[model samples]
Each structure stands twice: as C-alpha cells, then as structure tokens.
Target: MSLDKRKQAFINLGHFLNQFNSNGIVKKENVLHNDLFFDAFKMQIKRAEEYNSWFTQNNVLFALESWTNALHHQNIYEWLKDYTIAKDSSKTIAIIMAGNIPLVGFHDFLCVAITGNKVLAKLSSNDKYFIPLIAKYLEYIEPSFKGKFMFTEEKLQDFDGVIATGSNNTARYFDYYFGKHPHIIRQSRNAVAVLDGTETHEQLEALSDDIFRYYGLGCRSISKIFVPEDYDFDKLFKAVYKHKDILKYTKYVNNYDYNKAVYLMSLFDMKENGFLMIKEDTSYASPIATLFYESYTDLEILKEKLNNDSDKIQCISTELNIADSVKLGQTQAPKLWNYADNVDTVKFLLEL
Candidate 1:
C-alpha cells in the first residue's frame, strides 16, 4: 500500500479507539463497523483485563485513548512530516513484545507498518490477543494492509530485521541471536522525578499518576525521585493519597504487602502511607508500590548525576524546568515523536 493509504487506515483505527475510555464504552454514530466491532472491541477489552490483571479496564482504555488522540490525520502528519517515508520494498520485521503494560509494543508495530514493512511478531504470552485483532481491524479498514502483519507462536525465522524489547538479560540474548541482522533491541529503563520542595500540592498529586499508573509496570512510570536533603516526605505522601484506592487491587496489594514485609525484616528505613512507600535508595528500579528516593545537595550536581545515568533513565519528570524534563503527569501520555530509549524507531525502520 502507498503511505497515504496506510496512514489513512491508522487514522480511521484511531477514530474507532476513541469510542472506549475510562468513563464508559459508548458506541457513537458513523464509527466504522460499529455494528460488527463496537461490541467485539468491548469484549476484547474485558478479555484483555481477564487475561492480565495489570491490564485493568482503566489502563486498557487509557492506552486506547492515548492512541486515539495520536492517530488523527494532523497528528500523524506532524509526526511523519520530517521523515522521508517512501513505500519501499517490504521487509519482514520481527518484534519481540513485552507485556508489562497494555499495548506497549504497538508503537514499534505502527512504525514498521507505516513504513511499508511486513511484521513477524512474537508476542509476549502475557499479552497475546489484542494486536492480532488490531491487525484484523486494519485489514478490514484498508484491504492493502492485509498480509502486512502477522503474529506467530512458532519460533521466528526468515525475517529480514528484528526489534526486541525485554529485560536487560533478555536483551543480551537478543543481541547474541540477532547480531547478524539489522535490529533494534531494547532493555528495561525507568523514569525518575526530581523534586525541589517548591512544587504545588496540585503538581505533586499529578506526579502520583506518573508513579502509580498501570500499577507501575510501564517503563514510563516514575520509580525513583530525587529530593533535596531537607525535603519533607509528608507532602508527597499526602499528594499520593489521592490514589489510595489502588489498594483495592489484590495483585498490587499482594506486591505491596510482600515487599513491605521484606523491607521491614531487613530493617530498611522507609516511609509509608498505607498504600505507597517511599524509601531512601540510590537505585532507580524500585519494587511495585514502593518508590526509591535520594537527596540532592545541588541542582548542578544532580544534573550531572542525571547526565551520567542517562542510559538508565527514560523521561525525567520535574517542575524545575530541567533539561529533557517531562511535565508532572505527562510521561505515560507521550506524544507520537517521543521514542522510547531516546532512539528513533522510525529512522531505524526507514534505514532498514
């Protein structure tokens, strides 16, 4: 298919996804194939939640909603405007998806598809169903998209290029296996927030969403924070209390209870407010329901520290107007151009 045809198909798919949200799944008039798909899509959302506890309806809808906002004609054009995306000869691109959060791997798929490459995806067992259904939806919307993407349970073979997302360990394995092929293999990364004690209660509360959304499974979720030496934890605790209802999820509560017990037995110094925990830690990757924190003596020194550890960081959220700082609550709601790992997937795909 031509680039315009492929782009139009995704824009239409965005219109379809706009129907579902956290408020409620309301089918609207003039949506494509609502008679056949609206109910089916709703059922798939339920099925996604049933298959993965982290795939809560709220989280699934949020992912869909993010895509809906991104898939508009203007947004797509803006994202692709700089790129010279020619519908060249199709190459099969293999994707090893990670299922930590709902639809986490869709951007890679979208990049490959939009650039006119065929997809051979080895989906995470934890997240197996939805993308294939999306492929079907794309096929129906643009007949040319048919046969452009396919999923497989069997061992991947005969693909021209590879794009894998996994833990650092799995990434090592991917590097060994796909070393000969042109590839984009990724490792786990975490986001951190720097606090200066000047943030409003409103900003701090908004920061809670950056920390707790998707049960802290997404790479974009804030797992660590940098606070000044004299910063108070009470303000953060109070702000995060807005999400205290997260205690209702058994999976999260179990993780919270187990991690808390281990920390207590180990005599780790930490603060908790029933639902979330904040510990003085030097590390970036914290346990679920727990956030690691460190004290910064000066913004200049902290900036250097952040620069040194940039490889381990994703988006940094703060209100200090720091370099590359994402807003308090906008990390998970990334724009189309905000490539993960700071690597441009579109440029990578186009080069292949």
Candidate 2:
C-alpha cells in the first residue's frame, strides 16, 4: 500500500477504536482514560489488568500512542522502495511475539504488514486478543489482507524472513533452527538506573515508578541501581518506601520469596519487604526479589564503563547527563521519531 493509503488506514483504525469506545464495547479502567486516538488501547489495558498489575495501574500511554503513530508514520511502499521480497504472494513469514509487556509484538507486525508479506503469527498466549483486533481492522480496511494474515499454534518453516522474540535461552533455539534464514531475533534484556545521590527525594520517588512498574517485567524497568560511593541507603529506601502499597499484590510476594531463597543459597546478603528487595552488586540486571546497588566515584568514569559495556546495558537513568550519562529507564520505548532498537527504522524500511 502507498504511504497515503496506509496513513488513511491508520486513521481508519484509530476511528474504529474510537467508535468501539463510543459503543461501549470496552470497559474503562484508571489507565483507560479516553484518549481520542487510542481508545482501543484503553480497552487492551483494561483486559490486561486481569493478569498483570504493571499494565493495570500505570497506564503505559506510550504503548498506545506509539502503535498509532507508528502506523501513521509508516510508509509501506516507501519502505519497500529498495528491498526485494519474493514476487510470489504465497510466501509466508513466521512471527513469535513476547508476552513480557504490552504490545511488544507490534513492531514486528508493522514490519511484515508494511512489507506486504503473508504473516504467520503465533500470538503469545499472554497477549491473545489485542493485536488480533488491530489485524482485524487492517483486514477491514484492505480485504486482500484477510488471507494474508493469520494466527496459528503451529510451527512455521520454509519462509522468507522469520522474526522471533523470546528469552536468551530460547533465542539460541531460534538461532540454531532459523539461523540460516533472514531473521531478526530478540533476546532477554533489562534496563538500569545511575544515581548520583544528588537527586531530590521526589524525583527518586517518581523514579520508583520506573522501577517497580509492571513488577519490573518490562525491559525498560530499572532492575539495577548504580550510585556514587557513600550513597545513603536510608534515604534511598525512604524514597522508594513511598510506594509501599505495591506489596499488596500476592504474585509479587511470591516472586520476592522465590528470589530471596535463591539469593540465600548463593550467599548474597539482602533485605526484603513484601515486594521489594535491596542488595549490593555491580551488575546492571537484578531478579524480582532484589535490586542491585553499586557505588561509583566519578560520573565520567561510570559513563566510560557503560560505554564499554553498552551491549549489556539497555539504558542509563540519571538526574543529569554528567559527562556520558545515558538516560536510564527510557530505553526501548522510543519517541514518535525514535526507531526500534535505536535503528533508523524508516531508513531501514526505505532501503529494504
């Protein structure tokens, strides 16, 4: 489809969503505030609340806005202007989505749809309904897409390019099996926070949202804490303690117990409340029962180390960009123009 046609379809999808909201087909939750363009997203969040707290309470507005904008900004014909796909319409591609957080699969959906390929999508059992709604809308807009997009529990092979998402362990299986095929494989990842100890208690408290949000399930959640040496643990705990009610969730308590047990066996000293755990470590990622706290002296030096280890680090959140501060907790979720995985997606698509 042409860019103008695709944009029109996107607007139509947005209108369809608003129309759904108008007819009361979806329920309203705290996160489901009536955004004019992203009403379907509110419905998706309300549905997700039945399973996950992070999706229920925080309302990841970005997830909704990003999908609509990604579609609107997409230029299907332009993205395919350079690359070549098999001229055969029968060619199919397999897509395996992640249930880690809301709508992480949308990126791959946009990729295949805009490329005009037959999509053999295996929806994550965790996210069974939401994307199918979008797909249904797309079929409504372009009837030819009906046979082109499908959902299945079956494995797929003999395709053009395969895109699969899973944990670091499963990625190896994807690699060994689909390695020779053209593909983009995404593996497990986590984000981190760098604290200079100069931040106000209020900012630190808000930062807690970035940490415990979604129960630290999103790749963007802060699982690690890096700080200046001599950082005050009392103050740090005080800042996070403001969100003490997060402990009320039974699942989080179970995760806390499981992780604390593992730590005890590993001989790591730690303290935990009902939901949150604090421990000392140099790593950037931590388990649900614990948060890794590391001390540093120089922001520049820390930035250098982060730069050296950029492959392992997803984002670096700090109050100020001291020297090489890479803003943390703001990874993966890109701005309207920010491309997926920090690659210029528009350029990639255009050059396809």
Candidate 3:
C-alpha cells in the first residue's frame, strides 16, 4: 500500500474522533463510515471507562481530541516530510505499550504503521479498548490495513524490531530479551517546571493544567518544579486554586488524604492547600496529589544540573529563555515532532 493511502486512512480516523466530546456526541455528515462506526465508537469509549477507573470519559475524550487535531493531512505530511519511508520491504514491529495515561503509546503505533511496518502490539491491560477500536476504523477506511495490525496477549514473536515503554526495572528485562533487534526502549522520566517568581498569575494558573492533567500520571506531566530561593508560596497556591475541582475525583482525594497523612506523620516540611501538596525534595518523580520542588541558587548551575540529568527528565516547562524548553502550559500537548526521550522514532523506524 502507498504511504498516501495510509495517511488518508488516519485522517479519516481523525475526522471520526472529532465528532465525540464531553458535552455531547454529534455525528457529522462528512465523517467517513459514520453509519457503521459512530455508535460503535461511542460504546467503546464507555467500555474504556468501565475497564479502568483512571480512564474517565473526560480524559478519554481529551486524548481523542488531541489526536483529532494532530492527524490532519497537513500535520501528517509535515511530520513525515523530512523522512524517506521505504514501502517495498515490510517488517513487523512489536510494541509494548504503557497505560499510565490514555493512549500513551499511540505515537509509536502511528510511526510503525505510517512507515510501512506491520504492528504487533501488546496492549496494556489498562488500555485495551481505544487503540484496537481505532485500528478497526483504520481497516474500514483502508482495507489493506486489515492484516497489518495485530494485538496479542501471548509472548511476542516474528517481529524484526521492538519499541517498549516501561519502568527502569522493566527496561533491563527488555534490553536482555530484545537486545538483538533494532529497538527503542524507554524508561521512566518526569517533567519539571522552572519558576523565577516573575510569572504572571495567568501563567501560573495555566501551569496548574500541566500538573493536574491526567492526575499527573503521564511522563509529560509536571511532577517537579525549580524555583529561585526566597520564593513565596502565596501566589502559586492562589493560582492553582482554579483546579481545586480535581479533588472531587474519589481516587485523587484518597491519594491526597493518604499522602498528606503520611507527610504529617513523618513531619516532612511541605505546603498544602487541601487539594495539592508541594514538598521540597531532590527527586524528579512525585507521588499522586503531590509535587516535589527544589531551590536553585544559580540559574547557570541549575541548567548544568538539568543537562547532566537529561535522561531522567522528559521536557522542561519554563518562561525563561532556556534551550529546548516547552512553554509554561504546553508540556502535555506535544507536537507531532516532539519525540519522546529526545529520540527520533520516525528515523528509527526508517532504519528498521
């Protein structure tokens, strides 16, 4: 199949996703296969919520909307414009997806399919519904995709390469097992924000989205902050008050209560505003309902520290003129070319 056919199939899928939202589901007359897929996709969304409590309807729609905006013809063309994809030789690429957030590994899946490779996906148990349903939609749009995609619960085999997302521990296992194949194995990494106490209230409020979205589960979510010394907490706390509604989620509230109790029992120095807690720590990964922060004496020294620990970091959010830093509120909404772990997935797939 031609790469143009594959790209058009995904653009059709994007149009299908654009019809559903939290307010209501509206079927557009122009969307392809609406008569067959409109109702089925709605049911799949409900099933996804039932399968995992973390996959709430809002979050699921958010993921869909993000992809809907991304899969336009122009966007897809621009993303692949720099790469030369070889469609003559077909290979199978196995993907081990991580389900910390909805569709966390969909980017890898898209790369594999777009680059003319068969996808052997092992879906995370927490996220079994959405991707497979989308795969079916793609098959309907372009029948050639019918046999190119496979989802399995058994051990993966008969693949030329692998892309796996897991913790630091599982990366060791992936390295040992998939060592001989061309692969990209991603480990845990967390995002951080840099604050110089010069940020506007609006900027800080937008930063709250980076912290609270997906309940801070995804690697792109901001889990830590770097602030200048003697920074006051009053403005930051007041700004994040906009997201106090997040506490209404039962699981998030439970985590807040439990972590707050533990911190109090241990007498840790921290600050809280009932919904979110900020603690001073040197760690990058923070628990649910909590954020870790560290004070930096010198901006240059802190830059050096972050550079030295780049592998442990995903993307940095800052208003300062820092190299490769994402805007304050744009960390979670990554562009098509914002490769994870600073690794080029399209280049990897082309080489395979």
Candidate RMSDs in Å, in order, are 0.9, 5.5, 1.1
lDDT of the candidates, in the order given: 0.91, 0.65, 0.91
Q: Give the lowest summed-lDDT range of ten residues in model 2.
A: 28-37
The collision pairs in model 3 are: none
List candidate 3 stretches off by more than 4 Å: 22-24
Q: Show the lowest summed lDDT stretch of 10 residues, model 3.
A: 82-91
Per-residue C-alpha lDDT of model 2 across residues 218-290, encoded as one tens digit per residue:
7677888888777877776787886787767777778888888888899988766656778988776787757
Q: Across residues 78-177, which tens digit of lDDT does each residue of candidate 1 receive?
A: 9999999887456899999999998899999999999999989999988888788888899999888878888989988999899999999999999999
Clashes of 1: 0
TM-score of 1: 0.98
- In angstroms, the error of model 2 at 218 is 1.3
Mark the regions of model 1 whose C-alpha exceeds 4 Å error after superposition. none
